[model samples]
Target chain A: MFVTLWRMITFGFQNFFRNIWLSLITVLIVVLNLFLMSLVSGLNVVGQQTLTAVRQKVDLSVYFIPTTSEQRVDQIRQELLRKPEVQSIRLITRAEHLQELKKSAVDKGLVDAAIDALGDNPLGAGLVITSKTLDGYGAIANTLKDPKYQSIIEDTGNNFQTNQTVISRLSLIVNRVQVATLWLTLLFAVIAILMVFNTIRVAIYSQREEIGIMKLVGASDAFVRGPFVITSLLYGLVASILVTAVLVPILSLTNPFFAQFFAGYDINVLGYVREHLWTILGLEVAVGCGLSVISSLFAIGRYLRV
Target chain B: MVTFEHVTKTYQRRNVGLEDVSVNIEAGEFVSIVGQSGSGKTTFAKLIIAEEKADKGHITIGGWNITHIKHHEIPTLRRQIGVVFQDFKLLPKKTLFENVAFALEVAGERATRIKSVVPQVLKIVGLEQKMDRYPDQVSGGEQQRVVIARALVHRPKLLVADEPTGNLDSINAQEIIALLKKINEFGTTVVLVTHNREIVNMLHKRVITLDHGHVIADQQAGKYLL
Candidate 1:
């Protein structure tokens, strides 16, 4: 059996070299499939990171009136920190709030002049609230609504609800990104599969005489069909290496652009690929082998009825 | 030895391939099946090799009934019978040596055995010197000889030559016929299927003449009497 398998694999290579150009085209198509998948995956990771970064920025600020003492605000901050729902809360003094307002995305100089015109620190002290989980804001909202702290806590009508909406929207975008990657991968898979099927069909036609000779020589179906499977394997093997060779440099070049686009976030696509190189290669080879083998089998089936 | 009893084969389009064909050949016989195109000569050869199912008949090779041969069992039957096609059916990409070795390879023969056997067959076909040449790189006669070499690697009990010399020149055709005679002399049953009148008459062997999917004549020490 080993001998036969080895011979079949040799025959598969012989057949492969005959139509080197055609086989190269098949390898390219597989490479394109893998390339698209990797790019999409990398982009999806960056997209999720960006969305998470934005969601992390979504904090419900509880403003206490300027009359509330710094000690009292610290007490409220300590109490909120004790709750399981509250991840962390930073107490912002009136002066710190004014500084933050001056540094907002708007015209910083205009904001400073307006703050200076106020003649005193008019901004109220507040606690920037963060929840431990994405949906934990509801419980934090309930905690803030406690009767004891109600008078001190500013009546920010439904800030938790608004933050939840933003969070849910970001979650939706993340989900959409995931779904889009899946669809794009599937679409490329379908295209690659069709190319494999068509290429194998042509290969089968060219090798019909060889197949006939093989059959006449009393080759079992496995022996006759084994070469095509081997050919697909060769395609996958070669394409996998080529894709890696091409993709690594490509990811390296594109990493800078990605990092710049998602400025504050770390989008090292090349790093991710390097970390998972073997896994990516393994999955690619598996997918590539499966695609070509199944496609060749389908194309060669009806013709091998003899 | 091969036998066909009341074999009837019809195509899906209702074209008759063979009708009520019944014949038998004893061991070590050189039988030439002669007919014009579409006269079931190829069909007769196909049945012997189990390449085509006998729609309604009992077909056997050396007493093994293969009329209803299963799809998976075809390779086994074919291994025992070497078939030489008129087209030679040599893989164009493979060298003559590899072509011959491929036959043995299919049977899962070991490298040592294949190395030992392939050269001997190529020598028998007088192609040992040109064994490395691809089919397109060789003359038609040499290619046909390569096909014969490939067939002989199995040491098949029965050798079926379906128009084996049809693509050759007169001299090459005669050489192929001479080679088949030589193989038959070694106690192998030979079934030569052809329309070439000269080959059949030269053979002066057992002749089975087919016409319109029926055997109209079967003569001992016969000529091409179509």
Candidate 2:
């Protein structure tokens, strides 16, 4: 039985070389399928990273009027920080806020206008409140609206209004992308299944007579299917190599552009690939070969009726 | 050693491939089934291999009743009964040697057995020199000989040739018939199904003539009587 299995594997190898074009064509199809899937998968990785970084930069600020005393503002900051949902709150004084705006200003004209307006710094001390997740930032914003903290607000709490809108919009976009990626992966998976089915169907058609002859010569169904399964395995192996070769360099080159948004974040898709090297290759081979084997066996069993 | 008792094969409940066919052949005997295209000669061969099961009957081969043979056991029965079709059925991509070796490969014959058996069979069929040549490289007669070599790999007790020479010329047909006779002399039961009346008459073996799914004649030392 070992000898038979060895011969079957070797025969499959030889037959693959014998029909090089067909094997190559099938492998090419597999590569295209995997390439598209990997591209979508890689894009999803970048999308999540970008979304997280953007959300991290966003926070609601509760500012007091410039006339409000520093002792009261400090007390309000302490009270906000004590809330369970508030992960962190930073007290930004009027001078610090003015300096931050001036440092980040892209235009010198805006800085001059800000200093000249009202003959003094109109910017007020505020507390920049951040939550653990962007989704819960709105709740923290609503908590600041309580009648107890009404004195903490300056200018009817308009400071957090714009930030709240941005966070909600970002959250909606992220949710939509998640749904789209889910459906897209599902769609591609279906296409991959169909391609595997048709590929195996055509392969069986080519081997139809040979299958009958093998059966006539006393070859069991397992014996007949072993070669095709091995053939598909070779196809999967080649496809995985091709996809890896193409994806590694492309990801390495593009990850830096996306990393600029999030400090200390590296778009090292190659690193991810390296970390999961065997697993990724194994998954590709398993999916590609497993699909072909299942579809071919099913088709042969139904149509060949052997 | 094969017998078909009241075997009937109906396809789609309309076409009769084989109808209540009853026949028997003892061990080491040579039999020719002569018939027109649709006379069920091929179907009879298929029935023996259990490719087409009889609608109703007890069909036995070499003492095993195979009328209701399971799918898994069919291959074992097929291995015992070597069959050669008119199409040559040789893998086009493989050489004459590999084509012959495929049978041994499928049956898991040892390298020692394959190396020893393949060359010997090729020599018997006069294809020893052309073993390295592909099917396209060989003549029709040589291709048929390679297929014959393949059929003989198992050293089967029963050999069924369904128009083994249909694609070959008269000279090739004569060579094939001679080879069949030679194989029969080695104690293999040969069942030759053909329409070649000349080869049939020349064999002077037991002949079973069929017309429209009915066996009209079964003669020892039979001739082409149609």
Candidate 3:
């Protein structure tokens, strides 16, 4: 058994090196397939991060009547905190609102005119509420419309509606991209499988006479089929190594571009790839070896009838 | 020993490969099967090695009925009976040494055993000096010699040669026949399938003549009478 296994391994290497061009082509196809798979995964991570950043920027401000008590405002803040959708909330006093308006005024003359014209702080106190998700904003808006707080609330800011539109549009784009990437990846997977199958078929076809001779000389099915199967596995192993070697440097070089594009969103593509290197390589090995083995099995089956 | 009890083999279009043929050869005998093209000589060799199934009867080699040999058992059967073909089916990418060692290698022989046996067989075929040469580098007769060496590596109890000299000239053909005769003298049963009357007449051994998939004559000390 050891002798048989050794012969299989040596013969497999012999076959692989003997057909160098074919092996290269097979490995190239596997690399392309793996690279596309990693690209899709990377895109998904970035998309999720961008969506989270957009969701964080969306908030609803509830303005209260100036006569509303601080205790009532504190109650509303506590109630919002109890809800899972509300990520955070902060109180804005009437004085703070006026100070913000005054700071935003381009000229001191306009600010003074506004303060003198009003004769007092006309701004109302409010609570600024940030939600965990895009849908959470709508949930908070519904909660604010309750009759118990109707008299105390003056108006809800328009930021929620504008941000909702942005969130919905981003969701549509992301969903479409996900679907398209999935289909493209699947299509490339099919092509890669067929290419492996055909390459193996041609390799076996060239060795058909040798296969017959082996059987005639008392070679078992395993003996005749082992070399081809081993050769295919080598192709997968080498291709995985090549893909990793190529991907790491390429990702590193492109890191700055991706980092700059997602500057404030904090989507670190390079970091994600670095953290998941093993997982990515593992996936590539599984796919590369799996496809080659299946293809070799099918190709070798036809000539083993002898 | 080999036995064929009313063996019949037919093909997809109802073409007869062998038709109700029955023959037997005892141990340590040199037997020749001669026929024209499509006369079932090759099919007879195939059946002995369990390459084709007997359609209507039984075949036994050394008392083992291989009429319906299992797929996996074919290898074991083949190892016990070395087979040689006319085309000299040598792997082109392998050297003569690798070609001869391949038979034993497939049988799971250790490298030490292969090293010892391959050189001995190549020496018998007078190609030990040229063992490192690839098949394409050798002459036709040398290639056939390599095939014979490969077949001999197993030291099989029976050797089946199906027109092994068909592609060679008269001189090379005689050399191959002489080699087969030498192997038979060593007590291995030899079954030579051919249409070459000169070699068969020269053998002066038992000959089975076939015509249209049926045996026409079976004679000890037979010449190619057909």
Q: Where does model 3 sit among the CAPRI classes?
A: high
DockQ of each: 0.81, 0.70, 0.81
Question: Candidate 2 versus the native: TM-score?
Answer: 0.89
Give the C-alpha miss distance for residue A31 in model 2, angstroms: 1.2
Arrange candidates, best lDDT first: 3, 1, 2
Per-candidate iRMSD: 1.1, 1.4, 1.0
lDDT of 3 by residue, B54-169 (tens): 88998999999998889999999998897888999998878899999998888888899889889988998999999998899999999999988888888888999999999999
Against the hidden reference, what TM-scores do the models get? 0.89, 0.89, 0.90
- How far off is residue A62 in model 1, in Å? 2.4
Model 3 lDDT at residue B142: 94
What would the per-residue lDDT of candidate 1 be over residues B1-226, giving only the tens digit for each residue?
7989999999889999999999999999999999999999999998888888988989989889998888999998998898899988887778889888888788778899888888888999888888888899989999899988888888888999999989999999999999999999999999999999998998889999999999999999999987
lDDT (10s digit) by residue, model 3, range A1-306: 887898999998988887788788777876776676666656666766776666666677788887887678988999989999898999998888778778898896888897899797777788989987666777787788788877688864465466567666765775676677667767766776777677667767878988888888889999989998898899888988888888889989999998888787767877877898899888878887887888889888878888
Model 3, residue B224: distance off in Å is 1.9
Q: Which segments of candidate 2 are over 4 A away from where they belong?
A: A64-98, A105-125, A153-156, A252-282
Worst 10 residues of 1 chain B by lDDT: B101-110
C-alpha lDDT values of all predictions: 0.83, 0.83, 0.86
TM-score of chain B of 3: 0.98
- Name model 1 segments beyond 4 Å from true: A66-125, A131-139, A158-182
Q: Which residue window of length 10 is worst by lDDT in model 3 chain A?
A: A155-164
